[model samples]
Target: MTRRPVPEYAPDRLTAYEVPLRTGDALRTPHDIAAILRTVHTGTHIYLRDKVGTVMGTTLFTGDPATVTPAPFTNDDWSLTLLRCLASPSTEELPEARLCGFLFLAPDRLRLYLATEEAPSGMTAAGVRPGGALTALLAALPALLDEQRLTTTDADDPHCARVVDLTDW
Candidate 1:
């Protein structure tokens, strides 16, 4: 069943981040989240470990951005968006997951949304991390673009905020 779109943000509390990303090519086949997991996820994990701290799993989204109503912003087309939560700082110690982020690639740009609910605290901390997904995405982008993965035209970053943005519709 198609998951109904859920409200990811509240008007009273608005928080968003514009991840400055240097775009490359696409990362995987459009809408093929499974394929991305097989090829990019595992490899990207290493980079995330070195850059953004650590992540346990991810959620994927595909289709018209309009389907996601009341969005912070919109894009013409969007495919294979990935969302993951930043887990504990170290594997040895367990703590509440503080931050979460979303990643999506358009034909010409890469957009990242780090939820603001939990202030900027963790491995990657704040702003953009060099060795984080940014680095791994650079390597993975071309592969997706080469495959002509799905993308949007005249796309604008949504600047998503809230755990729902990373975990729900």
Candidate 2:
């Protein structure tokens, strides 16, 4: 059975972001959570990390956990669309997750929410950081997603925040 969809917004709150999709948007095949994830990444899961580990016994699946590979990057309008959605920070405060996809958005740091499935098409950026992912995205998405100037309220590093804008609906 299909599980009920996760709420687009947490109760009593709103996000600064908004996309073409709405809260009623379907979380199915072309527009599910992974769709958002893939949009954040584009065509690869390069953002996902599979760290090496030592096993004490043979009873565990000590290897990397496999994620379904994301689809192609045929969508030319993705970056522009996303940037526009995040262009304007709203006066109505929302859950942090809804605004930045990161938990916090500090003044100095910008919390980047790179989806796990947007790895680079090239083998060179396969595992190591793809230098152009953010650059390419920011350059292209300024107009389409002209919603807010996204910034983070934390030290410059990756970590989960308690709040973010999920109001991209």
Candidate 3:
């Protein structure tokens, strides 16, 4: 995959609450998110970008950025694709939804963080098919953000709280 840069998002600046109101079950904490990410096949990484075009840091999933088997992908590659997707316009008549940034894990794993100029009828970051950029990200992620903390990531774990929410979405 081509390399790209995923921007850094300041959770404080996030005001785009256009998310669909699903059971809080889906919204994962860092540990939970990390778990889901680990489920993906090795040699990949997962990242979450918010609706306001803010990029969070690279999710601390598996081994160090250095010595992972197969050499895990760098955030830069996935980040650029996400940015392009966010900047692209949607042809679909998703009247209630709009494309924001994306979750950059790898091939079959990702999340499509949505945004609405106004309040949303509900909060949902659905997996949407992309038109301009690669749609793999949209296809990879689950429809709803569910709970399930890291298998090893304890609530007491320093990165636990920060893992799922990552300080903030």
Clashes of each: 5, 36, 23
lDDT of 1 by residue, 65-159 (tens): 22212222123222222222232233564323333443434342334433332334322112222232433443343233222224223223334
| Model 2: per-residue Cα lDDT over 55-144, one tens digit each | 342112111113434344433334333434444434364312222342223322233343222222211000111122544444443232
The model with the greater TM-score, 1 or 2, is 1
- Each prediction's TM-score against the native? 0.18, 0.17, 0.24
- lDDT for model 3, please: 0.37
The lDDT of each candidate is: 0.30, 0.32, 0.37
Poorly placed runs, candidate 1 (over 4 Å): 1-99, 107-109, 115-169
Compared with the true structure, the alpha-carbon lDDT of candidate 1 equals 0.30
**Global lDDT for candidate 2?**
0.32
Tell how far residue 153 is off in model 2, in angstroms.
Answer: 40
- lDDT: the better of candidates 2 and 3: 3
Worst 10 residues of 1 by lDDT: 160-169
Window of ten residues with lowest summed lDDT in model 3: 159-168
Question: Model 3: residues >4 Å from true position, as ranges?
Answer: 1-74, 89-92, 95-113, 116-134, 140-142, 145-169
Q: Against the true structure, whose TM-score is highest?
A: 3
